[model samples]
Target: MSSTHHVTTESKPVRLLLIAVAAFILSLFLLLPLIAVFAEALRRGWELFLASLKEEEAWSAVKLTLMAAGLSVPLNTLFGLSAAWLVTKFRFRGRAFLLSLIDLPFAVSPVIAGMVWVLLFGAHGWFGPWLAEHDIRIIFALPGIVIATVFVTFPFVARELIPLMESQGADQEEAAVTLGAGGWRIFRSVTLPSIKWGLMYGVLLCNARAMGEFGAVSVVSGHIRGETNTLPLHIEVLYNEYQFSAAFACATILALLALVTLGIKSLVEHLSGHTSNSRH
Candidate 1:
């Protein structure tokens, strides 16, 4: 017979000191920087902050950023849902390899991912001539931005769903099918309700990454003011040109987005927990 022993710190003073150290590090590294971004943004006054966001280049960047997120989020959500369902509901050869492929974005550098597309679509690349012949511009355009965002955010939804679905298993889905429900019907009636919270959590994270992605989008985007610049790229441009207030002003938007994402994510987790407990 064997027993497990749990080791824990019992000294109150040591525990208190550890907690204090952690709090200090959190404040110094995370909280303070966020505070500075907002303070610096609003330092020149609210009017200036509003004006900075209202600038032509700034507004354009906002639009492009929204466009990229709007396009990429849905595409990735669909792919994630399909991939997660396929992986979790069936046993197949090369299953592990397929999962590794899905996780490729996380392993690859964002810059390298962007460059891979460039190599495939840029002038003198294999498809470049074909694209040019068709008068379609991909690299250095909206298409490239959307594609890069999709790649970087590829794993969020599927990663969120795979383990949850695996743990939940396919018993309910099989039962629904036994009752003569079709694929879409079963998915909507049974599977969706089971995984909706996880789906939403994944989507929120995907949208945040889509909006905030910098390195990949930067490589694909030409940084053309009022054209290809996303919010992060625009912020960099402003800072490089010595426009500190405008840069921080733009940063506040992204920071606010991150805050909102975090709030929603927390709420989702709480609601999911409450529902789970109620079910049990």
Candidate 2:
């Protein structure tokens, strides 16, 4: 028994060391390009980098990107949470079909998704006449950008919440109901607390995607410089126009945003683990 225990402990360290090495190699491969971008940005010096931020077109792209991301993240969160709740908390026909549909964006190409939106809302398309009559333009506008983003990011929150909610079980909610707690009261006190971390995780992921989304948005936004153009689209525009420094600078900012978002997600996950343990 002593020899067996020794072998088991020894094997665990070997397994962990292998995993650590593999992860390190993968991370290095992933980070090389990002490091190259930062190196190039610095090569151009700090003054140029600072000036890139002050450029009028860059500023417009930043503002539009932030606005679209801000608007879309909350809306996606609401839709995600609602979908998660319905799918996880209830049983109904076509549940599997609904879940599959939620993930359709992941499988569909972004360009194709853009085309579908165009077909639905373009001037000669399905809702075009109605929208034109009301002067409510969608395609080639901010509304189109938002709609495209929402479509692509629809699954993030729901996917995050479903497993968390499922793991939490319904015991606490049942207890609240037994005590005559109302629906809102039970959800606020029990459900929300249980899933808040997961929800935030999803929101952060959605925000990142919304900020970086390009293809679908580009198709609908019409690439109007300083107007419908988002950050990613702006980068493409700059690259196309041979403004390499500005494009790289904008790309670097986006990379930084993604990194910050990832850091927050890691912190949230850490806190969530502590919260989960304390609840036990």
Candidate 3:
């Protein structure tokens, strides 16, 4: 029995080593290109890199990207939370269909999603006549950019909250009701705390998507420099114009934003997990 146990224990280390090696190889495949971009940007010299920041068009792109993301992310978060609540907390006909539709953007190509929006809001499309009558343009404008982003990011919060809320169960709310707590009071006291971390995670994911969204935004934004162009579009414009260093500079900034958002999210999750364990 002792000899068999020793053999089993020794096999565990080899298995762990294999897993570690596989993970390292996968990480390298993902991280090497990002490392190359930063290296190239710095090689272009600090002066050229600083000049990229000073470029008026690059600044405009940054501003526009932030504006669109800011507008879209909050709106989507609210919508996602509401949709998640409705689908998970209530029993209704067609609920599954609604849930499935939330993930439609993931399946559809972003380019096709852009085309759908264009067809609906373009000069000769369904709502076009009414919008035209009111002289409201959506395509090739900021509104169109926000709309596309919202469509693509609609599922993030809902997806995050569903499993969390489901696992949390309704026992706490029932207990609150038994104690005569109002609906709002129970939710604020119980439900909100339980899901806050998951909600933050969703918000971070949504922000990442909104900030880095390229395909759908590109179709509707018209690539209007210093006006409607977003960061990703700006990077594409710079690359196409043979301004490689500047493109990398802009890309690096966006990448850093994503990394920061992810770090905050991970911290929130860790804290939430600790709190959950303590409560248990």
Model 1 ranges with Cα > 4 A deviation? 1-9
Better of 2 and 3 by TM-score: 3
Highest TM-score against the true fold, candidate: 1
Weakest lDDT window of 10 consecutive positions for candidate 2:
1-10
Q: What TM-score would each prediction reach against the true structure?
A: 0.95, 0.91, 0.93
Rank the models by lDDT, top first. 1, 2, 3
How many clashes would you count in candidate 1? 0
lDDT of 1 at 191: 96
Could you tell me the lDDT of residue 31 within candidate 2? 77
Model 2 segments more than 4 A misplaced:
1-24
Across residues 1-280, which tens digit of lDDT does each residue of candidate 2 receive? 6777666655778989989999898778887889877777666788887898789989999999999999899999999989988888778999999999999988999998889989999999999999999999899998899999999998999999988888777888889999999998988888997789989999999999999999899899998888999999998998898767778888998999999999999999999989889888
Candidate 3's displacement at residue 248, Å, is 0.3
What alpha-carbon RMSD in Å does predicted model 1 have with respect to the real structure? 3.2
Q: Comparing 1 and 2 by lDDT, which wins?
A: 1
TM-score head-to-head 1 vs 2, winner? 1
Query: What CA root-mean-square deviation does each model show from the true structure?
Result: 3.2, 2.9, 3.1
Per-model CA lDDT versus the true structure: 0.95, 0.90, 0.89
